[model samples]
Target: MPFNWNWAFTWEILPKLLHAALNTLLAAGLGYAIAVVLGLILALAQRTPSRAVTFVIREFVEFIRSTPLILQIFFVYYVGPQFGLRLGPWTAGMIAIGLHYSAYLSEVYRGGLQAVPKGQWEACTALNLSPAKTYWRIIIPQAIPSALAGMGNYLVGIFKDTPMLSVIGVAELMHTANAIGSSSYRYLEPYTLVGIIFLAISLPTAALIRIFEGYVRRKLGLK
Candidate 1:
C-alpha cells in the first residue's frame, strides 16, 4: 500500500486540536489541585488516633484505588442524574478525575509520612511539642521533600489520563481527534498529532517536576 502524508491536513487540524488541548490541561490542573488537598485529608484521617475511624478511612481509600477510573466516570456521569445531581461534561470529568486520583495521592502522602524516622517523632515529643505544632512545624516540613517526586509524577499521570475524559463526552484533545478522524475519514494525522501534543506537554512538565524534586532534595540536605 502506498502511504500519503498531508501537511495541509495537519496544519488545518492543529489549531482545533490545540484548543481542545487547553481544556484537557484545565481539567488536569483543577483535578490535581483537588486531589492533592483531598488526599491529604484522607491521609491525615488514616493517621488519626481512633482505630475505627482510621480503618474506615483506609478502606474507603482502598476501594477507590482498586477500582477502574472509567467505571467511576460512568457512574458519575450517568448515575448522577438519577439522584437529581447533574453536571456538565467538564464538571463531571473534573470531579471523576479528582476523586479517582485522590485515592492514589493519599497513598503517596502516607508513604511520605512513613519515611520520616521514628527518631524525629521522638525528638518532637521530647521537645514537648503539641501534636499539631509538631506536625505543622517539623513533620510536614520533612515530609514535603519526600512527597515532591511522587506528587510531581502524579501531575503528569493526571495529564496523560485526561484523554479518558473523552469517554464521557468531554471535548478534550482526544475527543477532538476522534471528531476529526470521523469527519475526515483519516486517522493518521489527527491521532499522530494527539500523541505529539501529549508528548510536548508531558515531557516539559516532567522535566520541571524533576528540577523541583532536585531543588527539594538539596533544600532538605538529602543529597
Candidate 2:
C-alpha cells in the first residue's frame, strides 16, 4: 500500500480548522493586548528610582522568561484552584500566554527605551516637563519606532504559540486537528493542513511586520 493525499477530505476538514483558527486569533489578540500594557508597566517600573521595586520586577520578568510557557499554563489552569482562583481553560490559557509574553516584550521595550538618547531626557528635564508628559508626549513616541519591529515579531510569536492552548483543550486549530485525526484515524491530512495553515498565516505576518516597522520609522522621522 502507498500513501495518497485526499483533496476531498482536506476540504472537508478545512472549515473546522478555519473555525478553530479564529479561536487561535482571538487568544493571540487578547493575550497580546495584555502583554503590551503589562510589558510597558514592567519596563517603566524597572526605570523608577525605587531599587527594591526594580529588583523585584526585574527578577519577576526573569522568572517568567526563564520558564517554559506550557508549565505556566498548566500551573495557572491546574494549580490555581488550590488558591481558590478557579479559571476556565480559555481564561487560564490567556493569562499564562499574556504573562509569558509580557516578560519578553518588557525586554523589547527596555531596549527601545534605552535606545532613546540621553539628550532627549535632558531636554525634557530642561523644559521641566512632568514625568507623565515626558513619557507620553516625548519618550514613548520616540521609543515606538525602535520598538515596533520587536513588537511585531512578538505578535506573530503569540499567534504561533496559540496552538499550546490546545493542550488545555481550548479548541484552537491544533486541538481541532487532533480531534479530527483521532476520530477519523486519518492523521496525515489533518496534520498537513495544520502546517499549511500556520505557514499561511505566519509568513505573511512577518512580511507585514517589516512593512509596518518601516512605516513607523518614517512616521516618527527616524528614517
RMSD of 2: 1.2
| Structural similarity to truth (TM-score) of each candidate | 0.94, 0.97
Best by TM-score: 2
Which regions in candidate 1 have their CA more than 4 angstroms from the true location?
Answer: 1-3
lDDT of all predictions: 0.91, 0.93
lDDT of 2 by residue, 71-188 (tens): 9999999998998889999999999999999999999999999999999999999999999999999999888888888899999999999988999999899999999988988999
Per candidate, the number of residue pairs that clash is 0, 0
Estimate the lDDT of model 1. Answer: 0.91
